[model samples]
Target chain A: MAPKYVLHYWPSIPGRGEYIRLAFEATGTAYTESNEPKTLLKHVMSCSKVGHPPHFAPPVLEIQLEAARSTKSRKTETSEDVKSSSPFFLSQTPAILAYLAPHLGLDGVKKGKNEEDPEVDQIRRAQVNQITLTILDLNSEVHDSHHPVASSAYYEEQVPEAKKRAEDLRKVRLPKFLKLFEETIASNEDEDHLYGSSLTTADLALFQLIDGIQFAFPKRAAALEKSGKYAKVFALKQAVAKLPKIKAYLESERRLPYSDGIFRHYPELDGED
Target chain B: MAPKYVLHYWPSIPGRGEYIRLAFEATGTAYTESNEPKTLLKHVMSCSKVGHPPHFAPPVLEIQLEAARSTKSRKTETSEDVKSSSPFFLSQTPAILAYLAPHLGLDGVKKGKNEEDPEVDQIRRAQVNQITLTILDLNSEVHDSHHPVASSAYYEEQVPEAKKRAEDLRKVRLPKFLKLFEETIASNEDEDHLYGSSLTTADLALFQLIDGIQFAFPKRAAALEKSGKYAKVFALKQAVAKLPKIKAYLESERRLPYSDGIFRHYPELDGED
Candidate 1:
């Protein structure tokens, strides 16, 4: 039986949760991709769920584990008996991705189950973790382009600062990240994926990372594309887009574009050199 | 034989690597503690060691592994025998701890070699990762204490914006983090440790987190500590201070206090109210 994955993300834009969605899609996994913002809001507002909640934000993955509840245990029950019928819900996209990847057979590790080889799994997961960490860093960098002056303050208030920072960010950090990816691809003996020569979730993740960067910094990215070092990365990204599952999802109303999400484009924040 | 730990750190302060150091001390593990900062710099700087061709900051843990060394039969003498030797360095503190915990018997399920228990490890690790993430966020908040207005600008350049952001930060986020920790301890069944009962690295980490917060925001912490909900947490901090290895190390010339590291104090940033 194919495992069903219900990925709950914000309806508006493809933010952090898109990585998980992409991985599930790439592997041809059966999953419910729901972007019901109302559903997400309800979960976030709930007391049991929002324990030590975020300072501000949404896009939580609500996971439902449906197994045959033991009818034998239900006959006589104490307060702690019967066992939780309602499934587990976790926030934090990185944590959720780390949790889910192995279950989907996309991660190739013992992962959460501990059934497979851990030594190998540890290395694999570490590689995955490294990729995600880089993605998170990239996301933060994109956010910084608009709110470079103050994360708490309005972007309008810091437009001057943003103008200054965006110049160096585009020229310095953008190329650095690209060249890093280029070198990573160049280092790979295999033509296909990032780690152990398999199409792990990391590549799917890097696609989102680069895609988001390109969306936000088109003027800068265009200059970069002309430089021609990241052809393999760009090719992999195009190939990922061409996947039938991904193509269908993109065509569907569910797939979101970059606007008011983690990757926001501000033409004023753009600087060309 | 007792597991040997080759901790790669700055040789200056117990920043992120302190968590591992604390674990080693608590267990009384017999191992070589090489405090070679220059050696660390050299190893991390070497492109041949890491796959991506540069350093990802300091403090990489080196583990020795022997692989089958997959090489074709003709091999052509392997083009100068390009292969890594006995030691393998793992970056990121969380990655290193995950590698060492099982070996040190700090892990719960000791099913011996090849034991694949991911849940027992994952729950604890996820919790640990959450705290580490929180601490990093908190440290960034600490950075805001000095340069709240911008990352690109130096401390002196953004003093005005820093002051206002720091004031708002002290009044709001500082208390929020402390209260969360207080609540975590008060609500936990195992009050001593933040994660599931007993002295896992998470408890020591929380102590470090709190200690850093206290050091960085003395006045705000004083106000927060008045709640008295973190009695066990405070006790754990005290207990860690008294640990023979930690105590000796602390008394030795080795342990250094906060400066420009992750946790820093800006007199203007903190407030009593």
Candidate 2:
């Protein structure tokens, strides 16, 4: 029997958790996701008390292994320790993805000796990781657009500053990041994927980023996509959208619409293209 | 002979480079660092053109491997291909530290089967990584205190908004993060290190963070340290500071002062304890 996997994340917003879901959906992996936001928050808050590794934030994946059955023979045990033996939990999105991708065949290829440039594999994977980090940085910048002065403060209290941040993100940082991604895609002349010939988690992440950007800054994302400058990026997004599993997931109820997420669609924040 | 390691970062500011430097200094590793700002910028800019992995920012580590010497016999001699064989570069501070820590013996121990809780090692390392990332997150928040509205703009342009961000950070966020670090330290029982019984890169990173916080917000950091709430965290800082190499590095010219770094000492931002 296949081991059971449970993912705990806020059900309403497809924020950072959506990145993990994309990999699972793309690979046709079976996993259950917690749907209650309050329960998810409670679990994250109490992660340390249960002797599980303290997760600073959520999108935690709990993996139940076959080895857990042996734990029944132990004499002295609490509920948490009993579960701890066979089922381990991992937190932090990137760490979880890196751990899972290798097992799921979604990681970069381990090139052979006969390959023309076998050394490029290490560098390729490192670059993929770098690009992924840059994407997260961009995601943070997008979040800051609305919460510029203080995350503790509401959007209404920081309207003027939000406008300033949105303007910089729109005019300066957005174009800069788009160009960087566009250049990376263009580097692989023959393939639509972000890394190598086959799809990796980085490609999936890139697709999600493009998707979120389109939803958040409709006018700007549309104008940029139409500009012909980032042709490869636009092409990759279309390609990812058409993948059979991804297409199905997008059409299904599982795919939550963008509202209160890292990439938010605020009409005031979205300037003219 | 060991491989030559060269670190490239901004000359004046400790910035992100300080994290990498802490590991090297604590372990007494010998590595050269570039001091000229123009050369550092040029190297970072040309990273892509050289066919090496492009670092989006500085604190790039260049490793020249002895294994790379075998490539001389290969017929393919493009400049990019030639350089790719002998020397490789890694960027992004967290990734660099993760890659180097194992070689420097600063990584967590691989527990034996006889150990009571062998399963804890994996969880331990993941939590350490999480803490390191959280430290970076705090570092970013500290930076935003000085440049709340625009990073591209000068500090003078965003003074008013910076004050608001600083007030929130000094009063709310700083205490919250200090409390988190304090809780983590207290979890280790009698140990002075952040994890297990010995020192790991996370401890060095924690030390750097405490050092920077003290420099950037002297009034607040000193008060927190004196209040005795974070006793273990303060003890860890003292322990790391007394490490022979680290103490030498601190008193030497190589340990650059905190000017124009992520954690700048703005008098207004310091506020009160």
Candidate 3:
């Protein structure tokens, strides 16, 4: 049996976790989410030094495979402050994705066709990398929609700036992103996925991106999705949704609806076409 | 001799290519740079359809090892038009770092003493990811220094707003980032590297990041660097610089300096204490 995968994400908002969820769905993988109510409400004492960052942000897909007790612990766990020592238990989103991609077959896309086809993998990997970066850029845009100035500042404080950012996102960023995805799909005519015909992490990401955008900007997304250019993306999303295990999971309580996730809808941060 | 690698980068900038060059130097990899001005300029068109977009601007790394030619003959290439249909390429700076870290023996820090410990990899990988994301945030700040409004806008046009953004970046973002690196180093008390006391991609990135920051924000960086908190980061930069191959490479013309790269110097954007 494969390892029992555990996803650590803030319970309320989908934010980055949706990508992981969609990826698992696309692969028909069974995993549990560790999104307890206290996870968010409780204070997170960030790592001071010794260990890795304690669960670097949410949406971390923690691999539950037991190590062989792991190297006998060079860094001693005994310290007056846990913060001072005990080595970080875990953190870093890309590292998690890199570790999981190979296990989940999404990484195989990076490899070339033959046993020696590591070259082939580069194209796929690059595609995934590019999309992921784009996703982050989109994320920044999305973030600016609510917090146009300081991210740490409240929406109420920056509501006016947020309105401008939101308007810009709706008018410029959203369409630009959708068009880029549409172009990517159109460019990859024969291949069923972003890099190649078979599905990969890039596709899962695209699905999540579209889903998030649609949720956050329903009016704008409706207009963009109606343009008929997103048929392939729509098809990809439908395919992921229709996956037997994924569909079952979505239907079940496991699949949370979009609310406070990365792509949150403040309504006013959104507008109609 | 292993295959001579082909490095495809925009010849104009040292952005992402600098990281790759640092890795290659560390590994003693002999590779030819395909910094053809025409090729770099031409590839920009096809870059749009290449699937992913960086959250903003960037330098992408292309793996130059030869693969099967005639990617153009294949319909897959047709989906995404290319000025030159290269068989395989990798993009997004962090992903490229992840790919190269293993090949360059930078993974030794993560691989652990036994060489079989996966947790070591996970822990180190996590740190590298954490540092990379922080670097991206830092770069975004650097970009905002020049164009606070949007990337689509001209830099000169946004100089007034850029000054305010740069002020915020210098006072808040720069100190915060420097402090983070400083704290990580001070807390670890380990020699050199951020993860497990051995050189890794994190170290290379830290070196470049500090170098870029110092070059771009001379006044602020001078203050931050003089504040004495980033001692380890400074030490890491020196350690990496001392590596024979790296030193030779940096001295040689192959290592380009920053001008129009992702990290730029616009003295007007900054503020005095």
Candidate 4:
């Protein structure tokens, strides 16, 4: 029997947890999410007691590989903290993706083909991971668009500064990042995927990035799409959305909408197209 | 022969490039740094032409591994771009660290011992990487203290808002992060390093973080250190500085001081101890 996979994150918004959710959805992996903020906070605070490293933020994936282990490991009984007997626990969205990629058979490395050269495959995966991190950087910038002055402060309080940052983001940063991703997709001779023929986590992450951007800045994203400068990125997003599992997930209730997550759509921050 | 590592970053300050330099120096790996901004800009602009992924920012490490390959890989002859025949060109500081770690033998995995179990060792490394990223998060927050409104804007322009952000950072965020690091160090049985008994990149990163904090917020950091709350984090800093290679690097001219990088010292931002 497969061990339970529990994802702990804020219940309010998709946030970073969505990336993990997308992977599980795309791969058809059965998992449960403990989304309550208080629940996540409790678990994070008590992480030390469970022998896991303390994470600064939420979106922690508590993996239960109990079946693989010959003996059961003792877990601290905490009423507040979300308890798990999982031998392995992971945090950091990109790191979580990398750890889960091999387990879900989505590492973008094939067995007997071009993946024959282990060194080449490792380098390729590193490149994919690099792309993923760059996308994450863009995501952080997007979040700052709404909360330019300070994250703790309300968007209403930071609206004045957010306008300036959003203008720069919409005019300069957005196009710059999109063009970079555009070229990345164009680099491959075959218009197959980000890392060649097979779909990798980068592709999934890129898809989510586009989705978030479109949700957060509809007018700007629409204009960029219409301009056709970043055709490859939009096309890649569409392709991922069309994936059977992904398509179903999108139509399902499991896929949450963008609200107060990293990519928030504060009307004032989203400048005119 | 080992490949020549050429680090590309802004010559003025010890930015993200410093992380890679610490790793190379700690491992005694031969490497050179290209300080010219024009060279880095050109390579970034022409990254696609050279059949490599485009990077938005600098701290690009171009490894010259031509000797290992039988054939020369043609590169676009750009007047401004830093040319390299090395197939691997990595951007993003953490990704660069991960890529270089295995080659330099500083990956923090002990062989024929506790590291005999590959699964356990990989998890441990993941944990180390997580801590490194958390330190990076702290680094970004420190950078934001000065440029809270917009990264492209000058500190003088954002003074009013920066004051508020810095106040929160110094009074709230700093203590939270330092305590997290302190607890992380306390979790380990041996007081040797951040990752259990072995020295990992996280230790080097934490050492750098503490150094940056001290440079950027002297009064605040001194106050925090004097409080004896983060004793473990300060102890780890001392442990890392005592490393023979690291000690030599610190005393040498190669070790650049903090300037306009992520961590900058602004008396106003520093606040009262």
> Best candidate, lDDT-wise?
4
- Model 4 clash pairs are A11-A35
* Cα misplacement distance, residue A56 of candidate 4 (Å): 0.9
Estimated TM-score per prediction?
0.80, 0.88, 0.80, 0.90
Query: Positional deviation of A147 in candidate 1, in angstroms?
Result: 3.0
Candidate 3 vs candidate 4: the DockQ winner is: 4
Which residue runs of candidate 4 sit more than 4 Å off their true CA positions? A1-4, A36-38, A71-86, A114-116, B1-4, B64-66, B69-86, B114-116
Better of 1 and 3 by lDDT: 3
DockQ of 3: 0.26
Indicate which candidate wins on DockQ.
4
Q: Which window of 10 residues has the lowest lDDT sum in candidate 2 chain A?
A: A66-75
Interface quality of candidate 4 as DockQ:
0.43
**Model 2 CA deviation exceeding 4 Å by range:** A1-4, A45-48, A66-86, A111-125, A188-191, B45-48, B66-86, B111-124
DockQ of all models, two decimals each: 0.22, 0.37, 0.26, 0.43
- Tell me how candidate 3 scores on lDDT: 0.62
* Candidate with best TM-score: 4
lDDT of 3 by residue, B183-271 (tens): 56554547666665667776777788788887888887777667777666777778888878778878998778788666888877544
Off by over 4 Å in 3: A25-30, A36-45, A48-50, A53-56, A67-90, A108-113, A116-127, A189-191, A266-273, B1-3, B45-60, B64-86, B109-130, B186-189
